[model samples]
Target: MTTITSAQAYLVDIDVETVRTDAVQAFLKQETVFVSITTSDGLTGVGYSYTIGTGGRSVLQMLRDHLVPRLEGQDSSKIEAIWMDLFASTRATTVGAITSLALAAVDTALWDLKCQRAAAPLWKVAGGFRRDVPLYDTEGGWLHLSQDELVSGAIASRDAGWGGAKLKVGKASHREDLERLLAVREAVGDRFDIMVDANQSMTAAEAIRRAHSFEPVDLFWFEEPLPATDISGHERLARATTIPIAVGESMYSIAQFREYLERGAASIIQVDAARVGGITPWIKVAHLAESFNVAVCPHFLMELHVSLVAAVPNGRYVEHIPQLRSITRNEMAIKDGHALAPDTPGLGIEWDPDAIDDRRVA
Candidate 1:
């Protein structure tokens, strides 16, 4: 029996590669929280979750004060049981970001151990549908960039063999947004896929209007036009436009996703593994999206998500927003414009311990 012996959580702050702006907020830094779990059989697995800028300490505290204690002496092989136990332990904070993020940290570590124990890479262990998932560049598209910059970025991505590039929308006027999308569309040509995101900055009515205006560009998808809680609003927007509504990055529970799917509010699901809890529930959400014939295109944490997106048949494009390079020794493997799932065991993230120590905040 590979019983858990101990769990340790660490917090590290890594600056964003560049200025990352969206309709709602400017990304300050990545406040990454890492959880390392050791088993009785002398094995350790590392798992991590992140906040855009703040809340790392809160997540760390959650693990130290609540989650980690429960991990001691638990069976490392029982991933689902342990996830449920942690969820039940934090019942009061269930279905919230901090709890979910903390749970993800520990839950991922367990999965890392599970994969290592089996001597299989995560993509294969999870359900190897494909080894290489399509890649779409999001780092080049930010609300802060100029129109010229956006166009150049899209062209660069397309020329580099990427499948798509996502542009941040929600400009001051619908005309401004349309102009930007049109500029990128003209530069990238009709064959290259272009996606637009509002970062949940508009109302249902405003989103519908923008969607109609953007129809000429043939966008791949329209993402997060309204706040996550507004399912009815999303439903209205979905019915009002031909563009597919992509959501789930802000959602913290499976129930929220189910409601969106049931009401036909979303076409593409952007469920973030950290926000939704961990790989355990992440896979569940992917399967749930599959049941509805919706595609799973998860948001951020691309290093980890590359394997995840490759794990399931319904998985779509992996959004490229590289934020982990500073603290990690390896870059995600890419070939022919696709993010390849690492064949190495145990989450496939090569953490530089010295670099992590240098950035460690708690």
Candidate 2:
């Protein structure tokens, strides 16, 4: 055992107001959880687990009542083994929701510890394949924004030098979706790379229909049009439309990504390091995508995604959503529409306990 002497989870509150070209919304007002591991040798690492809203409380319960107890006296170096044990321990409890979220937090903390001990950036710990990645502003796609607002966000991202842009689709009707896309095209011009996220809001047939509607503008691809589990459906839709497909945030494991890739399901893979069992599995997915000549563009966790995307030669673009700065004292590194990797130690994040504590629920 590597001798981890202490562990604790904090329920940090997040309240960030995001003002985009479109409508403004408070990205989070709920609690976000962070797990900190301290080694007997005086090493420490911190990692976060978040639920978009109120569900963070349940993840907090799992960490406090269940996961934390298991970490006592274990060596922090055995991150892979620890993650597997926790996943298996919560098998019955986490077919979905809070349990899996808690597992992600602890797993990430262990990786943070490993990288810190090695004195390298995450991409170096994982293996540095690239240093900078093209980025796309993901702000244009939220459901709450108006069409003009969505178009405005797309234009702003383009003006900022982003290589691509993505907007939300599946807005109750194809007519509305077409209108938004057209508005964006007019705002940013027809030649720019544009993408759309259905957010798993459509059926396979609906995805195909909506994709065809934007065929003229040469969209980057349609993201998560159908649910993540429906490989056959995604395959069917791929054959039906010339538009390519993008997926991954909805997927939690490399096994699931392999299933999608093996079937030629998505031309673009969008993995989230925090969501898919931390940096380990996410790196594995990047390698898998490489063998297929596919593009690996990750979803959120932009603070962390910058490193992985920059480390992969075949990486596509990092999703840029600037909502976390209000909660964290430091901003994510982005310039010229590219997200820069952190030169700081660990994951380059220091928890703002006071800022985070301010937003906690009663």
Indicate which candidate wins on TM-score. Answer: 1
Q: Rate the local accuracy (lDDT) of all candidates.
A: 0.94, 0.79
lDDT per residue for candidate 2 within 101-207, as digits (tens), equals 78878878888888888888876676777667788877666767888888788888889888878877766678887887888888898667899877777788777
Error of 1 at 360 (Å): 0.4
Model 1, which residues run further than 4 Å from truth? Answer: none
What is candidate 1's lDDT per residue for 1-362, written digit by digit as tens?
A: 99999889989999999999999899999999999999999999999999999999999999999999898999999999999999999999988999999999998999999999989899999999989999999988999999999999999999989999999998889999999999999998989999999999998889988999999999899999999999999999999888899998999889999999999999999999999999999999999999999999999999999999999999999999999999989999999999999999879999999999999999
- How do all models score by TM-score? 0.99, 0.91
What value does the lDDT take at residue 133 in candidate 1? 93
Off by over 4 Å in 2: 19-30, 360-362
